[model samples]
Target chain A: MRVSLRQAFAYKLDFIFTLILGLLVSLVMIFVWYAVYANSGVSSIGGLSLNAMYVYFFMVNALSFITYNAAVAQTMQEDVQTGAVSTAMARPIGYNTNLFLNSLSVAIVGGLTVTLPMLLIAIVLSHTAVSPAALGLLLIEVLLSFAITTCIGYVIGTLSIYFVNIWGIINLTGFVYYFLGGSLAPLSLFPKWLANILMLLPSQLMMYTPAATLLGIIPMDEIIREIAVGAVWLAALVLFTLLWLRRISRRVVAVGG
Target chain B: MGLKREIKFFITCQRYNWLSFLAYRMQAFVWLSLNALFILYGILTVTIIYGVSSGISGWSYYQMLFLIGTTGITVNAVWYLCNPNGLVRQLRSGKLDSTFLRPYSRLNIMLSASGNVDNSTTAISSLIMMAYAASKIGVDAAGMLLYAALMAAGISAFVLFVMALSVLAYLLIRGANFVNGVLNFMSSSSKYPLSIFGFAGQLIFTLLLPIGIASYYPAEFVLGRLSLSSAALVFVLALLVGAASYVLFHKFMKGYVGGGG
Candidate 1:
C-alpha cells in the first residue's frame, strides 16, 4: 500500500488529468439531465425525483471515477507486450499479486485524493444528502466492484500474451460494461424488460447498486440481495483469475526485452 | 504536377495501411464489431431517454437519432480520414523528423500515414444509419446533398481542431494525454441532444468548442428547424476555424526540437 501510494504520487499528473475528465463528464451530465427534467415539465420520472436524479448522476460520477479499471488492463497489456512481465514474474512476489496490489493502490489513492473530492463537490453542488447507513454499504460495494473490475481487466490484459494488439477487445468490453452497467445512464431509465435483464447481470452491482444505495433509491430488502449477488460475482471472478494466471504462466514467453 | 504526385503518394500510403490492417484479420474484426456495438449502445441510450419522456426539448425521437447519427458520421469520418494517432506516435518517436525532411508538406505526410480502412468502414456505417434516419424524417434529395456538404465541412473542422491539439506534442511529450481527455469529453457529450444542456452549455458547445456544428446544426438543417443560411453560416465558421488552426499548428511546429533523428 505504501509503495502504491508512492507510485500514485509519482504519476500525479495522470491522476489529476483523469480526475478532470471525470469532472467535465459530471458537469455535462448535470446540465443535460437538469434540462431534460426542466424542459419536459416533469418533476419526476422513473421513481427519480428531479433532485434525486441529480444526486444519482453526481454519485454515479464519483463512483465511476474510482471503479473504472481500464488502467489495469492497459498496464498489464503493456507489461506483457513489452516483455516487462518476465522481470516481474521472476521476482519473489507473484505477478498477479503485484498487478492486484498496484491496481488497488491506484484505486485507493485516486479514490481518496481525486474522486472523493469530486464526489464532495458534486454532493454539495447538487444539494444531495449522504446517508450514513448507505455510505457504509457503499464502501463495501466499492471494494467488491474494484475487485470484480480488476479481475476482468486482468483477463483482458492476459489476452495480450497471444495477440499483438488486444486494445480492440479491451475497448469493446469496457464499452459493454459501462453501457450495460448504468454508467452511461441509470439502469432504471432503461425499458422495463431491458432493466430487468440488466439487474440480473453483475455489472449493475458495480455502478448502479452503489449509486442507488447511496441515494437511498434501493429498499433494504433489495440492498441485501444486491450484496449477496455481488459476493457470488466476486467469488466467480476470483476463481477465474486464479485459473487464468496459471494458464498465462505456462504460455508466457519473453518477447522484446 | 505536385498535386498529382501528392495524390499518388496518399493513395500508396492508404493502400499499405489497408493491407497491414487486413494482415490482422481477427483484430480488425474485433475492432469493427466493437465500433458497431458502441453505435448500437448509443442508439439504445437515445431510445431509453425518449422512452421516458415524449421527446427532449420538442425534438422528436427520430430527430435525436439523426443527431446521433450525424455525430457518429463526423467523428468517425475525421477519425478515418486522418487518424492523428499516427502523427502523435511519430512525433513522440521522432519519426516525424523523417516526414519533415521529405519534399511533401508535413500535413500531407501525416494525413497519408494515418489512413485506416477500419475507421472508414465505421464511417460508412454511420452514413447508412444517418440516411435511414433522414428517410424516416422525409428529407428530400437537395436536403440530403446540403447535409453531406455541411458534414464535410464539419469533419474538416474537427480534424483541424484535433491537429491543433496535437501540436502540443511539439512542446510537451505527454501532451496527447490532455488532448485525448478533452476529445473524449467532447465526443461523449456531443452524442446526446444539444438542447438538453441548457443555455450556458449550448453556448459553449456552439461557439467555443463548436462540436455542435459538426452534428447538431446539421441535424437541425435536415429537420427544417434551422435555415439554409444558418446552416451555411456554420459551414463558413468551421472553415474559418480550420484555417486558423492550420496556421497555429504550423507555428507550433517551428518550436519542435526532434526527440531523435
Candidate 2:
C-alpha cells in the first residue's frame, strides 16, 4: 500500500500543481477576507478577531487539502457502474478493506504533500496563536473529521449502484461543505437556528470544528465532544456502507462479459 | 436547412437525455434537490451579507441574487450544452477530425455538438430565481428589458470564453481537466459580489477571467452604477474575446495530427 502511495507521489508535477493550487486559493481567500475585515472595521464576528478569521480560513484551506476524498468516491462510483468492482471482489482482500486502505493512502499522501506545506506557510505568515494544548486538540479533531468525511464519501460512492450519475451529489456535498462548514464565512454569521441545525450535520465537522479548535474558539471539552460526535457519525456511516455493499453485491449480475 | 438540421440535432440530443433520465428519474430528482440546496445556500449567504450591509458595490442583495441566478443559469447551460461534446472528449480521442470533416463550420459544430439536458432543470431553476430576484428589485419595464438583453449577451460571452479556454486546453494538454477546475472555481467564487475581493480581484475577474460579465457587470448595470454605454462596452468586449479565442483555437487545431481511436 505504501509502495503504491509512493508511486502515486512519484508524479512530482501533480503534487506541485496541487500544492500551488492550494496556496493560490488560500491566498485568494486571505486577501478576500482582509477586505471584508477592512470594510467591517470591527473584528470578532462570533468571537473571531481579524487575525483569527484569517487563521480560521487559512486552516479551512489547509484542512480542505487534508480531507480531499472526492477522487476515491469517483473511482468507486465508476467501478460499481462499470462492474470493475467485480474484479476487486475476485481479489483475496475484502473489497471494503481494499477501498478503505486505498482511500486512506491517497488522503494521507495528498494531505501531507499539499496540505501540510500550506498549513506550515500559514502558520509562519499569519499571527495565528497555537497553544500546545490547542494544537494537540486540533490535530485529533482533524483526524476524526477526516475519518467521518471519508466514510460519508464512501457511502455516497456506494449509492452509485442505484444512481447513474453521482457527480451532482458530489458537487452538492462540496457546495454545502463550502458554505455550512465555515469555508465561505464563519458559522457565527449564520442565523442562530441555522447554526444550531448545521452543528448536527457532519459537514460542520469537516472544516469548521478544526478551524474553531485552532482559533481557540472551541474549548477543549467541547472539542472532545465534537470528536465523539464525529466518531458516531463515522461508525454509523461505516455500518451503513457495509450493509449497502452486501445488498448491492448480491444484486450485482456481472455485465459486459 | 442548416438551422433546421441543427435544431433537430439539438432536439434529438435533448430527447436522448430525457429517455435516459426517465430510467432513473428518482435519481434525477434527488440530484436536482441537491442542486437546489446549493442554490439555496447561495441565496442564504447573499441574503445574510446584504442584511448586514447595504450592498457590496452599489448593488443591493436582491440585485446580486439576480446576478448569481443569471450566472448560474448561463454557466450551467454552457456546460451542459457545449462542454462535454466539444472540448473534453473530442480532444482526447482526436474525434475532432470528424468535426473538421463535417459539412458545418467547425465553430458551429463544436459549439452545438453535445448537450447536457439533465442540467436543464438547474438552468431553469436558476432563471426562476433570477426572475424572483428581479421582481424583488422592482426595476422598471425598460430596465428589466435592458437587464435581460445584457444578461443574454453576458451568457453568450461567457460560453464563448469558456469554449475558447477549453480549446486552448485541448491544444496544450489533450485531456486536461484544468479548465474545468478553473471554471468550477470561478463559479464558486462568483457567487459573492466581486467587490468582496477588492479592486485587484475585481480587475482579475473583469480582464483575465471575464467572470464579471458572468454576473457582476450586468448586476452593476442593473443597479444603475454602470451606464448603458459601459454595459455595451462590456458586451462588445465579450464578443471580441470570444472571436479571438475561436480564431486562435482553429489556428492551433490546424497543426493537429489526429490521434488513434
Candidate 3:
C-alpha cells in the first residue's frame, strides 16, 4: 500500500492527465447518446433511460480507470527482460503477490483520486439517484472486477517471459478487453446473441455488470446469476494465474543486464 | 533538384524499412494484426451503436462508417509518414546531437528515418472500408475527388498535430508520456461524429487541437452536409496549424539539452 501510494504520487501528473481524458471520453459518449435519444424521439433504448445511459457510461469510465492497470504488464515484462525478476524472486514475497499488490494500490489510488471525483460529477450532472443497496452491490462487484482484471494482467505479464516482444499481444489483449469488456459500448447495445455469450466471460464483471447494477437497469435475479458466474470466473483466473506464474518463475531467464 | 533528392532519400529509407521489417516476418505479422484488430474494433463499435439506435447525432450508419474510416486513414498516414517514436528514441538516447549533424534538415531526417510500415495495413484496410461505405452512400466521382483532396489536407493537419507533440517531447523530461495520453484521447474521441461533442468540445477539437478538421469535417464534406467554402476554410486551418507547429518544433529544438549529461 505504501509503495503503491508512492507510485501514485510519483505519476500524479499522468493520473490527472488520464483522468481528464477519461472524463472527456465519457462526455463524448454522453453527448452521442443524447443526440441519438433526441433523434430517435424515444424515452429509452435497450432498457436504458437517458439518465441511466449517462450514469452507465460514467460508471464504465470509472470502472475502466480502476481495472485497467498497465504498470503490472509493463513492469513485469521489463523485470523479466532485465532479469530483475530473479533478484526480486530472491526476496521473501512472491513475484505475483508483489505485482498484484502494486496493481491493487494503483487501482485504489487511481480510483479514489480520479474515478471517485468523476463519478460524483457524473451522478450530480446526470441527476442519477442510486439507492444504498444498489451502490453497495456495485462496490462489491467492482472489487471482484478489479481482481479478475489484475489476474488477466498477471497472465499477460507472465506470457512476456516467453515472447520477448509481447507488445502485439498486449495491444491485442487490450483491444479485445476494451471491445468485449463493454468499455467501447455497453454489451446491452450489442446483438442479443452476442451479448449473451459475452456476458459469460470475465469481462462482464469488469464493466458491464457493475455499470448495469449502478444504473439500476439489472434485475435482482440476473444480478445474482452474474455474481455467481463472476465468482467462478474469478476463482478460475486466480488459480490459473498462480499456477502460470509459479511455472514461469521457475523457468525465467532474465536477458538484459 | 533538391526536392527530387529529398524524394529519393525518403524512398530509400522506405525501401530499407520494409526490407528490415520483412526480415522479421513474425514481428511484421504481429504489428499487422494489431492494426487490423483495432480497425475491426472501430468498425464493430460503430456497427453496434448504430444497431442500437438510428445514428450518432445526425449521421447515418454508413456515414458513421465513413467518419471512422476518415479518422483511421488520417491517423495511419501520420503514423506512417511522421512517426514520433524515432524522435522520442533519439531524444532519450541523446542521439539527436548526432542526428542533427547530418547535411539534410533535421526535420527531414527525423521524418524520413526509420520509416514505419506498421500502419500500412491500417491505411489499406480503411481505404477499402471507406470505399465500401462511399459506394453504399452513392457518393459521386466529384464527391470522391473532394474527399481525396480533403483527406490530404487532413493528413497534413494530423502530421502537424504529431509534430506538435514531438516538439513537446523536447521541452519536458516526460513529454512523450504526456503526448501519448493526449494522442490516445484525440484518436479515440475523433472516431465519432464531431456533432456528438458539444460546442466547447467541437471548438477544442476543430481549432485548438484540430483533429475534427482532420477527420470529421472532411467526412462531413464528403457527405455533402458541409459546404465547399467551409471545407476550404478547414484546409486553411490545417495549413496554419501545420506552419505554427513547424515553428514551435524548430524553436524547441534550439533549446534541447540532450538527455545525456
Highest TM-score: give the candidate number. 1
lDDT of 1 by residue, B1-261 (tens): 999988888888888888888676767889887776657756776777777876567777777777778888777776776644456666767876777788887777878776556776666677777788888888999988898888778778878777766766436544355555666677778877777676787888876777887888887898898998899899998898788878877888787777653
Quote the lDDT for A150 in model 1.
88
True contacts kept of each: 0.50, 0.17, 0.54
TM value for model 3: 0.90
Per-residue alpha-carbon lDDT of candidate 1 for residues A1-257, written as tens digits (9 for 90 to 100): 67767865553564467568767876676666776787778888888887777777767777875776776788778897788988988999987788877777777877887768867876787676778988888888888778788888988888887886777888887777788888767888888899888887778876899889877777978878878887899899989988987877798887776
**Candidate 2 lDDT score relative to the true structure:** 0.70
lDDT of 2 at A180: 72
Q: Could you list the iRMS of every candidate?
A: 2.3, 3.7, 2.3
Tens-digit lDDT track of model 2 for B51-92: 444435445667778877877876777777666324657756
lDDT agreement with native, every candidate: 0.76, 0.70, 0.77
Where does model 3 sit among the CAPRI classes? acceptable
Which one wins on DockQ?
A: 1
The true-versus-predicted C-alpha distance at residue B102 of model 1, in Å, is 1.0
In model 3, how large is the Cα lDDT of residue B201? 80
